[model samples]
Target chain A: MADTNETVLDMEVIGALRALEADGAPGLFAEIVELFLTDTPPRMKGLEAASDAGDMPGVEAAAHSLKSSCGNLGATVLVDLFKQIEMLGREHAPEEIPSLVSKSNEEFVRVQSALLNTK
Target chain B: MRIQDGNDPNSVGEGMDRHLARYHELKDSGEMPGLSLPEPGNRVPASSAADGKLRDEIIVQLCEGVADERRVQRFREAWTKTVEIVSANRSGICERFPYDEFWSHSLACGLAAHALSKQLGRGNAEEAFLCGFFYRVGALALSCAFPFEYAELMELRSLSELDELKSVERDLFGMDHVETSHAILVDLRMPDLLCATIGELAGQADGGRSELAYLVLNAEKIAGVCLLDESRGDEEWSAIMEMRRELGLERAEFAELGDAVVRKWWEYGDILKIHTRAVTTFLELDDTGITERSLLGLSKINAMSEYGSPLTVLIVDDDPTARVILKQQLVKVGYRVLTANDGADALSCALQHSPDVVIADWMMPEMDGLDLCRALRRYEAGRLLFFVLLTGRGEDEGIIEAFEAGVDDFFVKPTHQDVLIARMTAAKRVLNLRRQIEEDHRQLKQQLCRMAELAREAKDAAVTDSLTLLPNRRYATRRLSEEWSYSERTGLPVSIVMIDVDRFKMVNDTHGHDVGDVVLQRVAEVLREATRSGEVVCRFGGEEFIVICRATTREDVLLCAERLRSAVERFVTEGLAVSEKITVSAGVATRDETTGNVDALVRAADQAVYKAKELGRNQVCA
Candidate 1:
């Protein structure tokens, strides 16, 4: 199902991109987006599997890494969502993980589209 | 050019231009040393007192073959004595003034002048030394003539604004310090070379004041450098950088020389008990800096400690957050950490930085981790780069692909910092072990080189005194016997001058063996320097030397011995460990019709030396 409420590209990322360029690391945002696209899917898959298996540590670790990837790419909302999932996993409470993870996957899809278009 | 490389991370390109612009702005704004550069000519480059002895050593190195060591020593003594006389005379009138401080500054300038001249190969060390020390005569005269007034003036304005002070002095009393000093030195009948040295300080570049003159000016600057606060070291460094370039000095060489100068300055203040303003502590030689850099700077630590240094880890991930987490984890364990974004940057950074371990994300754009590994393998197998590829996909095919692409380890999507560090720690230990082995291999290579050097030296050194570096007794005997046979065949006379240091045992007893060793060495140098072309000088035994003067009779032999005696008498012990003068006595014997063999000739010389010793030491006897 298409999420109508989603904004593809986050405007906040433009500031981060400009800051990176000013730091003499121009063209870094594209590489960061590519890494986010490449790594998030597997990490998201790990969180889903670990949550289903009730492997709390596995879910926590996967969510944490995924959070890092999103944060770096300036996906602030996604990062916040992943942070909640990671905290829940760390507490061994997988009950709310299903809803959060589903939203995460949807957000990932939007992020992917936004990143490819930005590229 | 040597000071900063183009590719160096700490390049002074843009930053230096900014600093230069700021300096010019300050100049234009009349902040400091503006376009109103005081009067006409600049102070000649001269070394100051703190490292004057070290500068003299450098001068001696330059004068290796061109100037006689004895003559150089004499010149240095003359300079020292003249300065002592001038200052000693000033002590009567300027009793309350800080003469030690003033004298220390003069000494530093002289040494700096000497070192600069010797380094550039442009001017004479002697003239530079004389010019440097005596140039302060004007200030000394002012102090001596008008003690209270000079003291107030000096206290009001330190030497940093020496030119300003001079200008002020002229306003107060029709003559500046330099002018007064010049007049005083002229009245003292200072040599023309010394006078010309001071004159050149006022003279401009018609070929740049003989390079030595520039050194006199540089010495003044260097003395100022030693007086600057550590926080303001950049001023001194900027001046040194300019000097190094002008003198065509290599960066390392200049750094080494500067270190010597600073250390020598510190020592001078320590020895003289002069209450100098604290000098800048060079960062490279700082104890705490060394410890800190050893922890962080792997490459430098590798050079410093030949055994082992920390292994460098390069974390290559396009995700900046991932890279940061990984780098922080690695660095926490004391590994040197570097980071790169994506595969291309990783590749370039890896090649440039030469990290020991490289961890890369598998699916980066342009050059993915797998492709990066393969390219690295192809580019150089010697990388020992210990490639660890991070893949989100744990499928067998992807794993197989990673191996095919030459990855050494596989790390899954989420790397637990603890587990990663544990594995990397193991990797680091192995790398350190490898480095140790490499160090041992290098040391072994150096040992082989050293053995070769020792072998070469042994060939010559076996017959040479290790202390005085003169021909030993065995060589002397052999040389004399050979000369004797030649003399017998040619019917030409062969004479020997047997010289011994006067009361050498007392010298050893008074100054300890170290000073005794130096005295013996000095005496050898004097004898060697005094000998004629055909004379073969040798350290026959303890405090005794034999010179084989070929084609010479007793008269010629006595003359040679007398010259050597006079030279030894003139040698000063000011800079040496022992502060007492040393003398030598000699005896001459020639092979005439009555002489039996080389042994008899040696015996006769020995007997004559004893007679000379009995006839009051420091005389040549035949």
Candidate 2:
């Protein structure tokens, strides 16, 4: 796995974290990352399976869930990956699923590792 | 330490150093107390440690403590002044400001600030007020500091030239005004985060902040863009993206803010009264912020009431009385009117104001209305201008020539005021309709493109026959009837042909249905080859085909149908297996004045086809 420092968080993310801390919920940071790590993988897998099976609704649901999860964690890069996946799913481009799934997995792993290291 | 005189300076100097050290420690630790310190009247007596100079510095610092507050106040004043000036002298400042960006930005910032305040649970009107006010401070300051640069920047004539401005500013000032202002804000002891946000707003290099920075930066950018009089470049857009990335802002978030901002600006008059009043007070101190505010306010007011509508009308007439009459009438009708003495002045005025419409007199000293019309048609900006030429001679040939020169509507000279207003109102209605039609057309085209894309992907063969991928029996019959009705209504001839393969079931039994399908496809191909443009060929159920031709005569239809029959027979006999020779029987029909309905015509053709099949296959009967 790549080092956490290699994945630099945007200043906005840091500021939001600081704001969250100011709101007296500093622990929300760790909680959000944990939720993302726990929830995102299953959703990603489901998205891939749904795409492979040409299950458009399922693909859309999974992609949407992953997108919101990434946003909550302030995982911007992951959010973008999920957006592409969501677009593809909405377009019903099942053929594009495998590559998008792999790319998203890589981003998720990067974000996950960074979050763990931060904790 | 024990034996100092009461006025000794050494002890006082040491105490001053100690106090200074502690202040720096608090500042660095990000724990500075709120800026609302004790008022000067409530302060304890200063010890000998603090002298007059130190006290003066402290007073300056204290005043600077409310520098953000002061700056915000200044910005509001400038904004109001700008709105007023632009509104009053619509010809002068409207030519300069164009009322595009300022309108958009004011709206966006107002809304985003409202949302952000709510999100932060700040729950006060101050944050909402500040959100709209401070959001565009960077742009306002830049415009004030470098008016000429801003005017040039607004022109945005070329990307390379814009970059040159950036480089020039850096070389001349060591930093851009955006950075300079941000640095000044920092020096004045604003919150570090807000200072960072202001820096980002000024289009400085981005650093990690949160949505607040993104919010401010985006608001400023949108406001800057809203204020822009011309097109921006890739560098500007890239800067925006980089800013977004640094602030973790999505395009949708910005769009949402933009929508909210527009809504707020739309209601700015009601919502921003207190801020506007404060800004008015600040404007009396300095002239910078008032002009912008005035122009913005004018635009808002004009946009709200039809009586003050900002749509420009360029009046071109050499006669002073005529020009005055036209301007007064247009202004009375709520149009922002510009008067030009002749065609030359009119063209320049048209280029500057980009008026929604132009009313021009025919004969002039420098250039005639016809010549101006021709010239305007050639310019890209002139294409959308609603040109209404006022001709002394409204003769048919002259009118045709004016139409050729791209005059959308025309008005006769010495026209009555009521008549002129009616014509202009008609033109406005037509223009509005044209806009609606164009919008609808664009939406329809997009939908069609999407539908076509989906159709290509689905590969459904029901509407298209399975064998030849031509229109099936149902689609063919429907299309034929449509063509027939169209031709009948237009009093044009319509033609139809029905073809049937001879002994098709025998071929299917001899060589499996797959081979028969291939033969059917081959015959269908031959039929397709024989048909002309604007003709339909389709599989009409098993072993049958139909063709519909438009504007065709009976002789031509017969010849075409005969050719199709011959081609299919020759192709099948020469190209197919030796065990079977294929042929087709065809019947052709043409509609004349006597034909009452499309179905009767088809029935007549079907009878002829049956006769040909019965007499013997492999021939055409009409």
* DockQ of the two-chain complex in candidate 2: 0.01
Model 2's CAPRI class? incorrect
Q: Report the TM-score of chain B alone for all candidates.
A: 0.34, 0.28
All candidates: interface RMSD: 7.9, 31.6
lDDT of 2 at B498: 87
| Least accurate 10 contiguous residues by lDDT in model 1 chain B | B287-296
Shift in Å, residue B321, candidate 2: 3.3
**Model 1 stretches with alpha carbons more than 4 Å out:** A1-119, B1-77, B86-97, B203-208, B231-233, B263-278, B281-622
Q: Which stretches of candidate 2 lie over 4 Å from their true place?
A: A1-119, B1-309, B348-353, B392-397, B412-418, B439-622
Q: What is the lDDT of residue B373 in candidate 1?
A: 81
lDDT tens readout by residue for model 2, B540-585 = 8898898988888899889889888888877765544325778899
Residue B197, model 2, lDDT: 54
DockQ, all candidates in order: 0.08, 0.01
Residue B599 lDDT, candidate 1, scale 0-100: 86
